[model samples]
Target: MEFRNTLEFAQEMDTKDPLVNYRDEFVFPKVKGKEVIYFTGNSLGLQPKRAKAFVDDIMTDWAELGVEGHFYADKPWWDYHERLIPPLAKVVGAKPGEVTVMNTLSVNLHLLMVSFYTPKSNRFKIICEEKAFPSDQYMLQSQVRFHGFNPEEAIVEVKKRDGEHFWRTKDFLSKINEVGDELALVLIGGVNYYNGQVMDMETITKSAKSVGANVGWDLAHAVGNVELKLHDWNADFAAWCSYKYMNSGPGNASGVFIHEKHLDKKDVPRFEGWWGTKKEERFLMKPHFEPMPNADAWQISNPPVLSMAPYLASLELFEEVGMPALLKKQKSLTSYLEFILNEIDKEVDSSFEIITPKERGCQLSVFLHGQGRALFNYLMEHGVIVDWREPNVIRLAPAPFYCSFEDMYRFGQILREGILHNE
Candidate 1:
């Protein structure tokens, strides 16, 4: 449990690591000539070595079968998305029928909003965290305007009480209670992008549903980073992209979930598309829309086999290790990073601050005292792979699948040498 040095630390943890074989599974990033200690999987995950084979499988089908690839290939395009649903559903804690991989994140958010956000004249207001990811804010703003309402009056943003870095659960719960009658929907980010705080999803979902309001989650940062119970918690719906911790590659397909309870109801207002029709009768293509009876009903287009390929590969890793084990490793690795960062702070009395909450999903946001952009560039150039958010804050995520405790120790040394000593 304890090591006197970084090398000893890494070797010990790696020895006990159940998922260590996963390191060979990925192509870690190289800096100069060496494999840099990669700690930015929260921004973009390291690619799986199997990704090429997965993508090639689809390519091979296309080359050999041509137009018949839809139904004739090993993983036929006609049923490709189905191949991923069981594992995908298990990862997010939902029934297989309740989840479907679909378009990109922002696009799926737009589609879910169309059905979920029905602001009546009296109850037209929505509640959201202030400074949500810009993309989400833009989507909500556009949706409000398109529906002939002003976001100024329709959007209620909750901030940290006075000057706290993250919103406390009580603050959000109180606001929901006070405004519950007038709130039509609550759209929230599962993890705050700037601060790395994991929102209390179950409590938030219960409060929103208690007031008869639809709730949706943007799990862009939460999906693979933390354990979620979507069905047990009764979330109305949710959506997220797969490129980050899921390691599906950049701009890979995203997914959406609608509770099965909503699937059979014919009264819910939603945009209808050919892909949402029942698979057996899809070719018949009747004029009236009878949806496929679950989240699959949310799809508007056929599956893109190329994007789903890498995701299928990633999903296999999740199934093999299972989420509980992954989450356990994540907690230990992340705590190791935080411990070393604190040690550096104590040793140097430096002004660098880690404002990210301790309960965050496998990430810590470091705020530098000097010029942030310059300091961040120095770290990257020195072979410590991490990402910087604007104005300030560097995000370092020591992903459990491949990162070791030594990576954190090395990163801390990089910080102490690069930024702390210079001060």
Candidate 2:
């Protein structure tokens, strides 16, 4: 597929796009009375137009049914979160019984660690990627400290080699081997937030398991963006936020994946709550904590139906267009974006270094050599919504659901003009 930096070529690609119509499903923000080219789905997805209807239903049900809404609403609030499991399971590549919606990403991670991160006198070190998301880093540090160990000693970071933008699989595996008997758990971001590099989860999971270490993933940037096989990979647990690619509202509820092998185990340590008990026996209010037979066992409270409503709305779109179709378009769309970047770089004699490797999803984190924050401000003012990292990098994530080929082409034009004007 030859990509051209022309309006006609972009429009031709858009015409042939099977997912092009989905752009209308979302409500994009306007800049200067025109829809901006959105490239921040990795940060916060655009609000789905259907989200309003979903929320309205919940609001109406609450107004009419009051306390009875838990049992009497059209979609019973008591079981509302279950509606999200089927589609959410498919997104994360897990069985329906293996996934559940719960608290936010970091909160779920902390709760899951209670079950997976069991430290001993000799085996207490945890392996994670260097420069993980700040939330993850803080969580790991606090968890280690709570267990009476210094973070510098208990947490093993797999640092990228000098002069490299991304981590290598071999280095991670080697680090796991070096830790050997001391490795208690392996938890890293499935897709790095900074470089947009998709880690080799299957291989790394295998290696970590071989060393008698529990494994998990922080899929904040990976879920709904890349292909995942959490069940097949035998990951003990994983957690992700819904706001990014999942298109739930800001700081919305999160999703979790717990392997079937660990389900229904009475001995597994977890924070217990009434909602996590067996459904039939929950109302009985028995004193004993009999866990749910699936991933819902980890849930610590009743479902937040209001937060889950928008998520359910977004999953409807996922169900309409399966992940397979979304992934197929993602590859082509991202490649076209890369081609446009290279073409613009050559045309302007500018150094636009794409740090995101080939093993990536929709995001392309480019280092604008000799460019500054002024260029990012210029692009934003010109109706290009991209993310600016510290120093001189900008992350452009062209979400397949709403972003179009013409958005990429137009971004290239804006980028060229910004460069020229800055000079």
Candidate 3:
């Protein structure tokens, strides 16, 4: 598809977009009396307009039903988390029984690691990407130490070669080989948070499996942003937060994936709770824990109804629009954004370089060389809301649900002006 760096072209694309009506479903942020061009959905998505009503209904149920809400409410708090499985499964490309809503992303990762990260004898090392999200780094380090292994000796990091912004697939595979028989687990982000590179999880998982190791993913950025096939990819487990791409409220309930093969393995150790007990016997108050048959076995407690209401509202939108349609618009929006950014750099004699791979979803991480916080500050003051990473990168994600082509053009225009002003 040909792209033009002009407002008219942007408007024309927006006019033809089938998903244009979706913009109306979300509430945009205002800056200085006008709606800003929000490009931070990769970090935190805009709230859906129906979010309030969704939460209000849950509130009303609690008010009228009180403790009885667990059984009699419209959504039945006892099984409210089940309502999310169908659509959420579609989002991550998993079997309905393979998916479940649970605790936060890191907590879910730790719980899954308990079952998948078991270290035996010589094979006790873990392989992960370098400079992972801080929480992941801390989690892996602690997990290794908990097993009585030095983090420096047990954690093998796959790093980018000099002058490279993203890890090459071959290098990642080579690291898996380097770790060899000592590799007990291979855990990586499905889509890297810093450079927005989408890893080929299927190939990596197969490679890791061939070498007799377990594989998993942190899909926090990939869940709703990119197309995934966790079950098909044969990933042993995966976890992701809902707030970023799914547009659930901040710190909302997260989704987890446990391959069907692992679900029925009762001996595959986990930290259990009452909610994980088989439903029929859950209230029996037995001394021993009898786990559920699917991903629900990982649940530590009943889901937070108020926090999950917004997710249900967003999932309804996902069901209506679907990932196929959403990803289609995302391709065009991201391509147009890339084209506009390239033209802006040429027009302004700027030094910004996009580090994100072409295979990425909505995000483009731009390395703003020579220009620093001043350029970022200028754009924010002028109503372009993008995220700034420390040092020199600005991350922009034009979410397909609400971001329009015109917003992309507006961002390019503002960026050009900001660059020149800072210069």
**Best by lDDT, which number?**
2
The lDDT of each candidate is 0.86, 0.95, 0.93
Which residue pairs in candidate 1 have backbone atoms (N, alpha carbon, C) closer than 3 angstroms, thus clashing? none
The order of the candidates by TM-score, greatest first, is: 2, 3, 1
Off by over 4 Å in 3: none
Most accurate candidate by TM-score: 2
TM-score of each: 0.97, 0.99, 0.99
lDDT of 1: 0.86
Question: What's model 3's TM-score?
Answer: 0.99
For candidate 1, write residues 24-53 as lDDT tens digits: 889977889888988888878999888899
Q: With candidate 2 superimposed using the best TM-score fit, by how many Å does residue 87's alpha carbon deviate from the native?
A: 0.8
lDDT of 2 by residue, 1-423 (tens): 777889999999999999999999999999999999999999999999999999999999999999899999999998899999999999999999999999999999999999999899899999999989999999999999999999999999999889999999999999999999999999999999999999999999999999999999999999999999999999999999999999999999999999999998899999999999999898898999999999999988999999999999999999999999999999999999999999999999999999999999999999999999999999999999999999899999999999999999999999999999999
For the record, the alpha-carbon RMSD of candidate 2 to the native fold, in angstroms, is 0.6
lDDT of 2 at 349: 92
Error of 1 at 413 (Å): 1.7
Q: Candidate 1 has what TM-score?
A: 0.97
Candidate 1 local Cα displacement, residue 347, angstroms: 2.7
